[model samples]
Target chain A: MSPAEHLADAGLVQLLTPAGERVDHPVYSPLAAHLDGDALRAMYRDMVLVRRFDNEATSLQRQGELGLWAQSLGQEGAQVGSGHALAPQDYVFPSYREHGVAQTRGVDLANLLRLFRGIDHGGWDPTAHNFHLYTLVIGSHTLHATGYAMGVQRDGLVGTGDPTRDTAVVTYFGDGATSQGDVNEALVFAAVNNAPLVLFCQNNQWAISEPTTRQARVPLADRGLGFGVPSVRVDGNDVIASYAVTAEALERARSGGGPTFIEAFTYRMGAHTTSDDPTRYRSAAEDEYWRQRDPIDRLRLHLEQTDELPAAFATDLEAEAVALGERIRSTVRSWGPPTPASMFDHVYASPNSVVDSERAWFESYESTFAPTQGGAR
Target chain B: MTTERITFAKAINSGLRRALEQDPKVLLMGEDIGALGGVFRVTDGLHKDFGPDRVVDTPLAESGIVGTAIGLALRGYRPVCEIQFDGFIFPAFDQITTQLAKMHYRSQGRLTLPVVIRVPFGGGIGAIEHHSESPEALFAHTPGLRVVSPSNPADAYAMIQQAIASPDPVLFFEPKVRYWDKADVDLETPAEPPHTDAAPTGLDRARVLREGTDVTLIAYGPSVAPALKAAATAAAEGTSVEVIDLRTISPLDTDTLVASVRKTGRCVVAHEAPVLYGTGAEIAARVTERCFFHLQAPVLRVGGFHVPYPVAKIEQDYLPNLDRILEAIDRTLTF
Candidate 1:
């Protein structure tokens, strides 16, 4: 069978159907008690704002404001559900395309644009929010997250049974990163060490132009079973399932249940990046199929059916999204280029004579150029 | 001051022991470092002394070893990773260059990765193809990593501790061939003492092993010992050859190099790597730029041939020896 067919047969843990109906599984139904009318509405609002930010970022890329943009259009439920499931002490290591995860972590939406605007490598203090900088290199951050989890173990933070104090680590990567050696190695280390880690694989079904079938023959979640990690597959469009599964996994880690692999089965509804043309590699039929299961619309529909979301609330949310878009547009346009000497500021923690000498030489060389020409470049 | 005669391998072991004892955060991780005590036995008895927790025997994955070590550093632990052999380090090259080397810079100084990667480097022993190779130039070319090698037992004992204590990530390249060579090491002396009245010899500066006026022989790691031997042989022939052991390869102690070259008017760089795009090329470029008119002859380099490190039987022809170094010194004097 094809990889997609295998995933379909694998019996994904889903709490909500794609047609805006609430469902239940024997293992996951207990988690539905935590999602009241207010909580469900909050989750819907979170998805709407995250989509707004992602859309604004994509538009900025097309309008020549950003160097590049990776949109999280269809994967909002996967990101937001898992993001909201974390404890405040839990650390997050993200792949480059996690704009929704960044939103849930309280990162200033405008600051994240600095990376794509070419003004900074990473703009926010990762330590401030317990969310690490985005790793562009695929699959590398999984190992880092595992190691940090090991550190958490060493610090006597795990197995404490304190909901407010025990720590766990969550790492996000796409289906494409599963093919990297670093990711496989990370699984080995995490299993052997029994580190308190959760491997959140957002299986968006396409790694650039290649389909998920090209990367794996079995279900992606089953790959974790070989490494001794417990595996589960969740319908990523069902935010209820994503949040419940991740929350249970994080609790398992804190209570010394070791690492768990959670494959959030989702799809990419847009181009991989602003530079990619998805139409060349994929069929419109497939895109239309995934569009019917749009994560944001499904959550909004569920809220409407429950009468938890009023018309006034939807109108206010639309206005809030427009205001957010305008703020990002103005902020991006006002950012100036960094000084040339700023490049040498953080190469080493301790002073390096070689870098210092090179910085001085560069400053002297730049001085030799005419002010107009130098400033223009 | 107390001194002891020990092999270079023992000196490194002693250094690691001191580092582990001094700082509770320091830990060791490698493929066979725990029970096997490393292939070269450089980490022998460390696991017994510190237990398996401190000296960890990791899976046979080089990238995982390095990538996880960076994470451990982020948690405020100083991780000292071992890459088994010189050629085997390629698997972990991406982690070392892209992540470990750039983490501090990418985080804008908020994250400091105090990671030390210990690699057994260079060729001289009659080992297999991958075992005997010099790839120091590849690491030295990367920014944010401090690459250092010790030529003698003293520097091996002292420099390893300094590399671990460094706030920045450091690549400590151990000369596998010189592991058995012996020298006097001050066992009680801390490399960088907190209460020292005198300035300690730093890891960045090059040291003048022997002073001469006719020519200067500059080398690091395994090549430094051969350069010193070649200088001695040249001295017996009435040619004064100065020898400088470059403890740090990346920073390129050009001050000491230029001062010696200015006095001697001649220079020769020696290493086990190929001359093309090797550390020698960087030294030559900087020497020419700094001391444009000081030399009576152009800077010469003695290094491995532009070919793969040959098999056991013909390995001598591939590596630079004392005779080849002296031949380059003779050629320099003729000018």
Candidate 2:
């Protein structure tokens, strides 16, 4: 089939309008046609809980309960849409800012919080969730995703044309990732192998103080064209568009269409984290402009217009979100400092002598701390 | 299980071949690894056997190799990565030390970097300056890493398996000069008794090659061979010398070392790398302080001079050969 045929097969990237109207598109129709009212409502709930969790994690960081947090306040639609697009067995390799995707993959919110809270790296088992650990490196995760996709091909997990038999890999990175040498090399490795992988680039406008233009000379999707991989640009703010696009791309991958690059065009409404100040690099006016195209609001508006969700339901979700936020707070406080030896424990699968000695020294040292946590001392 | 014997390099090839056969998660990535079977023919014929899918050839980007290997590792694949040379490993050093080393810890134990970085290290290749150098100390010093050095063919065969089977990121230092040094290697017989998965060099302990009462000669990798020979020579001199091979360097096996020193009352450390700020000195200081009363004299060291390794012709002069080792042994006896 032709490249355009593949593009058309990928679906045009939407099912709902920004003003909450259900829309129709010939090309993007196939992927989202499967998402009935229940699915959209499910997507909405996933986004709300993830957002609330994101907010609480940020507060925990500020309260010194966490080391830091990479919030996904504005990129919820992109992550949730892509997260839901993946099947139970399909694997996901997420960059650090994929809280929304983790939620969609059924990762426990408390487990993810432990990472930033300095309690644990990540508590979820990849086998249980089929969602890999959060990768802190920028574009490097793509190489791994592509390599694993190559493994998928060898295992005959792709090109079987059977939905149950096929497994696709989705890796998340951002515009800043485009600059990394490993990212480009991943493209080389993936294209040469034709690994069944999807490279999802969330072009959230600014990477730290640098704009998208600084990293990419053209659109991120256009960058994939030279590698013979099919590419697309989606409305990251529109949950329906993000879902339909990712789902189509993943389907193409599973069916042996090779790798696809999706540029989720969105904006970072909040500072990079609570640590960043948007006022320094970006204009408040630009922030306001992206806020108008808010992904969650548009999805909520579509739900309200369809009467698929009631005012009472929205109120209840808001209340539920608050309670979810409270749960996150308690989880943070209850996650007391990890056992000090745990610091050196997982560094090696088996205990190496150097690490053991270090652990022993630390154990003795920590014993010196009497009643630091409670007043029982 | 049927038992088979092979050379050090062949043993590595067999280990990788089995990983590909048993688990789909095992993959090999490195330069010239696919078509050329690696610069040393260590991975020779692997590409033909497993095809290019399992054995990968990539552009010469060290940082990209390690940084991306971290990703592949994340995708539930145990990636066995090869650094072509010790000097070239520096380019990817940051990723190894910072990202791969701390990733699991930073993730708070949520990540298991079951990735193996196969590096050829140690001097005495009789080649260029960069080609001949012992850089294991650099990686051994890093936290969240297991640094291993294999002295003989059997150790090489066993250690590679252990390093790959590990859930942590391991720096497998293959003494470049000793890669071709053949020994009786039983691939079916594991490092441990009865179990096939015995760690190649075992875990974080020192092994005594020979027992003596006059003094202790402690070393590892290329230096171990000469230290053993030196101990034999010292035997003729009536100074029975005990030689200890430090398999894992970072932890230093202080318990074994202190015990040996306490018995011998004298110690002589040897290595191919420069002695200053070298593994020998670190061992010396640690042993001296920990076993001060037990020591007969300040821990005497036999190592390469404090300078960059010399040209090929003079390279042998630079490496601590048997003569230099015996000279140090004589000095310890005089002390």
Candidate 3:
């Protein structure tokens, strides 16, 4: 078939409008049945919670509580919608920015916070929820997903034609990551092994101000063609579409159809990080253009138009959001600086003298420097 | 029990096999380790005996190998990951330093990273430049990790097992050229596995190979064997020397080192890495503090010249040999 003949194939879906209108695409019918009122409302609830938590964490950084915070501000729909579609057994390897996905995967929000707060490497356990810890380096996690899929295949968990029992791995990366050698190598490996993996690329159009054009000559989804892995592009701002496309691709993988690449066409609506100002690298006009694609606004508008959103329900949610924000502020205030002794605890499963000596030395040194509610460093 | 003479490569290979046999959760993951056996064939025939599931032949992605091994470890599997070469280990540095090293501490005592990362390290063969670098110092410096290197077959057989049984993440550096060197190994009836509880194995400490009186020769990983040979040569020149193999670099076993340094007031440190900030620098500072009155001379470090590892042809000049070690030994005694 010709290249244009294969656009938005199977579950390559698009739904909803930039201005709160409900428009269904021909390829997106299967996904519509899955998102009834309750499910659709739940997706919105998740988006709210994820955005709230992200704002809280970023605030924590500005308030001198966290060392850094990688905000998922405008990318909430991509993370939450795709995250909701995953089964309990499916493994997710998230890039550093997927705070929404971590929340959706049932990882403790507080635990995720501790990593950025400089209190831990990764406070939460990856195996507990099948959510692999956040990988900071771009494109590296794709190889992990490939390896894990290979393991799943070895376990006879693939090609059984069992939808419930069979599992697939999904690796999350960005457009910037597409340039990494490891990501390309991962595509080649996944293709050759026919591993049950999903390569999910959230093309937020900016890798800290290096635009999408810098990452790809053709589109990133098309790059998978060389490796023979089927690829898709979704309207990332549309939560329903993002979730539906991911679900279909995941279903295909679980059914032994091998790997698929999804390029979520979206825009990063916030600064690259709290340390960065987007106004420096790009034009104000570009930001305003993408701002029209704000994911939450369209979903809210669609609910309003369809009368699925109640007048009292919206007010109640707004009140709940305020409470959550206050609660987060309180949590931040109550949280004391991490104890220096906590550093020695995790170096090994058991104890080692090296850790002990360093701990002891630091304890004495910290005691001299700072006085806390309970003790010293 | 019977002692059978074997090459260091076979001893390690069998030891790995024996460890896997003992623990069902133990797995071997690396490139070419399965079908191609290792580059040096130290893990030959392992894939056939254990099946491909237990011995995974991974793609050439180092960070992913190390990072995912952390996940596997969290899932109750003991993953013995191999970074094919010392120089190639840079790709995995972020995962090793940020994730693997810190995972245990981050878990707040709730998790155990029983992951062992193996690297065939140090120089000898006239291979390309990347193949002949010693980068163990970087790993040793990282917190929440254990680092160990073995020079001889017995230590290789013993230490590798110890590292695997360790609860914390352990960076086990295998001397590549020493893989072919021979030693007597006890392949007899199995003994109970040594120390499996979550007790911190004072895992990093220097092992004194030969005791001498005049000056101390310190080395680790690949340099230990050459240091031992230098010790023997130093004996011929009437300068009695003690050869101490720093089996573990990160947790510089201060007690053993201080005791050894006190015995031999003159000290000469030898290693493949450059002298500055190498494992030797940490030793020299601590030893100087503890054995200030006992020292007869300032600690002398005989190591690779302060430059990138030289081209293969001229590496002999860059590498420290017995003659250079003897020169350091003579200089230390002169003070």
Candidate 4:
């Protein structure tokens, strides 16, 4: 019916209300209680810094530095919360806009800019951080995550009782992806195989110009039941609830409890990407409504009222954010286009005569051109 | 050397069994592959021997089969997936071309997906639509994949193991019509895995099945036998013919084809797919380019009609047969 009505649904799990008050749930509160003052401060800092990084990238896109950029402006809580809940053994397959999750995975934020700048399809070593390269194709990586979970099962790494040896997988997508065949197929595979996976969906309420209602008649979380997967809906703007639900899901997965579908109810506070203009399709009133429930602002309010926000901590975070922006601006400017011949590299792992001959011919053909002042043309 | 006469399907089964035995990470995934042993029984005994884990009977979704195989490959497993028929592969085309083919290139050499997609391809099965069709040209045109097909039982046994051992993604197209054809397989001679630096032989080279001085005829998979038969028929009519079996599709073995064409001064290509933009056209263009100066005539092509595969009763008229191959050979000789 109404936007507020959707948020206030009884099925929504809210550990912290929008008014910055810490509420409790019978099952999830105990799961989230482990976040001490230090963990809370770390998560707050993550959201702030991620927002700063996203804003800087948007500016770069406007300045013609990046080809395109996808903003995770309102998804910091859902990303950072679930990201922080992951164990080292867990693997993550993220869609294109997961800057907060990337930060939590220790990925160098500069690597993300390489993709947007059109220098490379992916920029990080997935094995190094247990975070896969961002998949631009909608809902495609869900199957990859499901298959990886199957591999974990085949490797005898599930239900081992030893937490260090056990493994789980998490794949992130938006509500619109629930309509995709691959996503639905991933659910089927994960359920039938009883694979260790968590299908984390951020219902940001918009898939570009379309709303979630266009994608499904029922709540997105209900689709999981049809596939035999247990599911939960969380107040995605509440970081504590997101973290608690993800942690419990990961624990169940590691212990061979099969797949869990988590629908994080959130909003898109910005355009879908740099090329998109949300103003044409949505209302300013709705935008303002979501701005008041901004993930970073809500956490800031809670920390301030509790007196956990020291003056020095705020100052340091602001300085860090400024430095990160400068670094992003400079790093992106320094990267030049890759070598012309490098395009033929890595097309195949084994020897390919066709590629080899073509590369040789191309090199000789280019050599025919006279050298420019800088180098060969 | 130890030798045994077996059907083409049995050879592939033996090859798959050997690959499973050679490496612990090698597994099979497809519909009806387990318990039912696949619709064609190519994987008949594997599920019973390796159990359900190694030989998996997946859900009836083609995209899911390939997409999940990618994930399994990412986790350090070699997954050989079977697409039930030639026509059924279109459903998994996105995963094959976009994701599976480009994974290594996109990852900048950081990832290698050693997954093999086995499809029973080509016509003359006298079956329904989509069951008999040659779609190897589509995969061969893609840069990141290695496309191959086997004509006889021996090559089927050896090439399947080679495809499994390869570090790159391979599209193994099996000629379904010849699945029951019997031939002697040398069981004792283990095929050496293909090497990157060396010239390819076992899986990637073109072999001269018959030699002649007048014309060179090139064919692969199910069409190889017909080409050889056509060559024999031409020989009886006082025409010397050379036959070449192109085992690998993507690389084309230009060196071998060009050398033969240069020597013969004439060439002809034959296959089951449509002649328009088919594998035969590529072979003709490459042969012409390299052997242009030495050629006495343009390279001719013999293949299926440029239309939908005809019904089962009159399918013979639509496919390339001995008479068609002989006619094409005559045209190249006369020209």
Query: Considering every candidate listed, which one attains the maximal TM-score?
Result: 4
Q: Which candidate is the best by DockQ?
A: 4
lDDT of 2 by residue, B1-335 (tens): 55555666787777677667767778898999998999988899888988776788866778767766776776677878889988789877777887788767665577678888988776777677677777777877787887777777777776677677778888888777777777666667654521122433464567788999989999888788889888888788788999998877755678889899999999999888788888888899889888899888888887778788778888878888899988887887776
Predicted candidate 4 versus true structure: per-residue lDDT over B1-335, tens digit per residue: 98999999999999999999989999999999999999999999899999999999999888899999999999999999999999999988888888899999999999999999999998887899888888899999898999999899999998999999988999999999899999999876787675443534567788888999999999999999999999999999998899999999987788899999999999999999998999999998998889999999999998987898778888888788898999998898777
- Overlapping backbone residue pairs in candidate 4 total 0
What is the per-residue lDDT of model 1 for residues A1-377, given as tens digits with 9 covering 90 to 100?
A: 75558547357888888878889788877866678988887788888998888899999999999999998999999999888888889999999888888888989988889999998898899999889999999999999998888888878889998888899999999999999999999999999988899999999999999988888988899889999999999999889899999988898899899999999999988889999999999999989989999998888888888898899999999999999999999999999888888899899888676898999998888888777733423
Model 1's DockQ? 0.63
On lDDT, the candidate that comes out on top is 4
Point out the higher-scoring one by DockQ: 1 or 3: 1
Interface RMSD of each candidate, angstroms, one decimal: 2.4, 3.5, 3.2, 1.0
Model 3 Cα lDDT, one tens digit per residue, B1-335: 78889988888788799889989888998889998898988789999999877888877878767766765665467889888999999988987887677655655666677889999987878889799888888888888778888888877777778788878788988888788888887876453232333322334556778999888788887788789888888788787888888888866777778888899998888888887798888889988998999999999988887799889898878777777888888888778
- Kindly list the per-residue Cα lDDT of model 2 for residues A206-301, writing each as its tens digit: 788888777766667888898888998887878888888888889889998888989888877777876777788877777887788788889888
Residue A263, model 1: Cα distance from true site in angstroms: 0.8
Q: Identify the runs in model 1 with alpha carbons over 4 angstroms from their true place.
A: A3-10, A370-377, B193-200
State the weakest 10-residue window (summed lDDT) of model 2 chain A: A1-10
Q: List the residue pairs that clash in candidate 2.
A: A11-A28, A12-A27, A12-A28, A120-B108, A121-B107, A121-B108, A144-B72, B158-B200, B159-B200
- Model 3 per-residue lDDT at B73: 68
Model 1 lDDT per residue over B176-271, tens place: 999999989999977973112243367777889999999989999999888989999999999999999988887777888999999999999999
Q: Which pairs clash inside model 3?
A: A346-B104, A346-B105, A347-B144, A351-B200
Model 3 chain A: lowest-lDDT 10 consecutive positions: A1-10
Model 2, residue B201: C-alpha shift (Å)? 5.9
Cα displacement (Å) at residue A336, model 4: 0.7
Docking class of 2: acceptable
Tell me the TM-score that candidate 4 gets on chain A alone. Answer: 0.97
Order the candidate numbers by DockQ, best to worst: 4, 1, 2, 3
